[model samples]
Target: PPNGAFRGFGAPQTIFAVERHMDRLAEAIGMEPIELRKKNLLGVGSTMPTGQVLTGSVGVEECVRWALEDSDYEAKRRTLGLANKPVGGRKVRGIGASVFLHGAGFTGSGEDRLKGAVELDLLKDGHVRVRSSSTDIGQGTETVFRQIAAEGAGVPFENVSFAIPSTAHVPDSGPTVASRTVMIVGSIVGHAAKELGERVCKEQEAGGGSFAEASNRLIEREGPVVAHRRYGHPAGVKFDDATYTGTAYPAYAWACDVAEVEVDLDTFEVDLLGFWSAVDVGRAIHPVLCRGQLDGGALQSIGWALCEEVQWKDGRIVNPRMTTYIVPTALDAPPFHTHLVEEAYEHGPGGAKGIGELPMDGGAPALAAAIEHATGIVFDRIPMTPERL
Candidate 1:
């Protein structure tokens, strides 16, 4: 089947379903729905259903805690759930929340087997060229790579030029997905650059000259001085696709979201009131871009939860055009409060981990839970439309 490439992949489907289920669970138990999530949320050292123990960097628990606290989730839940609220209004209030994890790099041993490579060509002018097979994909990858290379090589960021993926020029770096470019490829490039610098320094010492002079000498003799390396994870990690089991990912990135919604009981029209997200990104190379990702993902998730629907009639989409297939507009989007918590991972380059998929994972669930809290109706399906409600 041909499916759109979504960062959250199928996880959003599960999150939508689970958020609805949490609403049902809350209604049945006469408990606050957000409380239910807080109670059952996954955290560090938590084993996923696949039995993969989170032995590496874990931050979902902190994300959830910060999100809930910052959003004043409990107080809002109480106000939205009042029994005497009018039923015919065009808008009603709701609040919901969800937590999610993103696996860094390729799943399981894919990275180890591929042995992703990066190269640094040290020029005579003290500048360098970073060669790698990774594509930027508008993810601020090039900037981060430059930063890593400069820091590693003890040079200025502007002194490095990156060569984009070309099989004829660069080594095979793994595909650019799973938020692996920074942690995996960046590390390899940084290491190679550092090694090249060390070699230049060593040659300078041996020849009784400065590093700059030795680098120039190497360039004169060898055209261009270069360093190359390949990288992989530790051995023995594996994933099982059939059962969605095994060590699904070697490392996980975690996030938590809280959504406030206003719903119309008569028409089931929903409006976002406010939203907040907390993410533990291991380390944010660019704080602004990281928050933008969270904001964008949250809006996308909100679209999926409340308005955007692939309407089906007899197994065919009835509404495929943008006119009918709705997404969240600026008016539809609520205020967002985002917090980034850095939990440095020892293994990641410069203590960095993945954050790309964390934002989308929890948006739908949180909104759905919020809606249920407001309306006292449980929603299981995604794209909760007025007709469904």
Candidate 2:
């Protein structure tokens, strides 16, 4: 198998290096690490290395500030050392923070080329059927898409239905990668429903009626009213895929994570005490779902950083069984405190940017920074096991 499919995809590795270096730079300059990160943070009008200008929804500063306050970061840094002052048996506690961003949706002009699409059919019973190849892999896609379809069609949510994703039944809405299911496909679903609504209104009897009543009349007369739409980029957004210089992503989601850890000097064990995260999700379509993504992704990253590792013998399998392969369970997890910041993206559906992968980018680096603060050791490698510690 290829080295992919993990949450965060390619971001956690680079973020680990970038954030760990920030601490090193702060130490070299005798400056507070948080202050250093703040000074270098990206804001509105900042240009990414890919030459994309962040026009709006750049909420990283707010994310960092909220994470710090929620975690009592500064106060903990000042006082947690006192908690470590046992005479012979010594343990050190430390807290660390990281602020970062994940590009939402496909890179550059990928969405434009893909032209993801959706179809809506108005049935004779005043119900709408969404026809799209967007699969719900437990990220609440069906719920969110149904909400979008209902709002666009001017019907009750219960009146909207989603066809199971099958090639013979649904249009190609592109693959469910790049965190674009809700942001891209849901937007198309909304537009298609709206178009279907307009068509129904135009074909129905002239007398005014509820959307359902109008849809019922139109579908009865016309057999079934159908409308389709494809995604298009917001106007004036330009990208040259050949040059690889343009809007890298239609929008970005920002986040900051703070990790609190206690390291035992004698045993060389690191225990996560607590974790705090603040995310700027553009807007959360569902608050509970958003928090679940953050908490789950954070735990996954923590496992990667602290314990999950694979051993190889002669380039073959070793410890492949679940019993031997270590992974973090509920007992290993710390209390997760998560905050959501809404900075709307004009192009997003209901002002939502991609969120599923954003939490994965911050946790490992934050945990590594916490370990460094606790032990004065720079851990560049992950899975910072007892032997490595």
TM-score of each: 0.88, 0.95
User: Against the true structure, what is every candidate's RMSD?
Assistant: 2.8, 1.8
Cα error, candidate 1, residue 161 (Å):
1.9
Candidate 1 similarity to native, TM-score: 0.88
Candidate number of the best lDDT: 2
Model 2 stretches astray by more than 4 angstroms: 1-3, 81-84, 203-205
Expressed as tens digits, the lDDT of each residue in 151-241 for candidate 2 is 8877889989999999998999998888788888888888888888777676555856866677777766777578888998888777898
| lDDT tens per residue, model 1, 294-338 | 788788877877777676788788887889988878777789999
Give the least accurate 10-residue stretch of model 2, judged by summed lDDT. Answer: 80-89
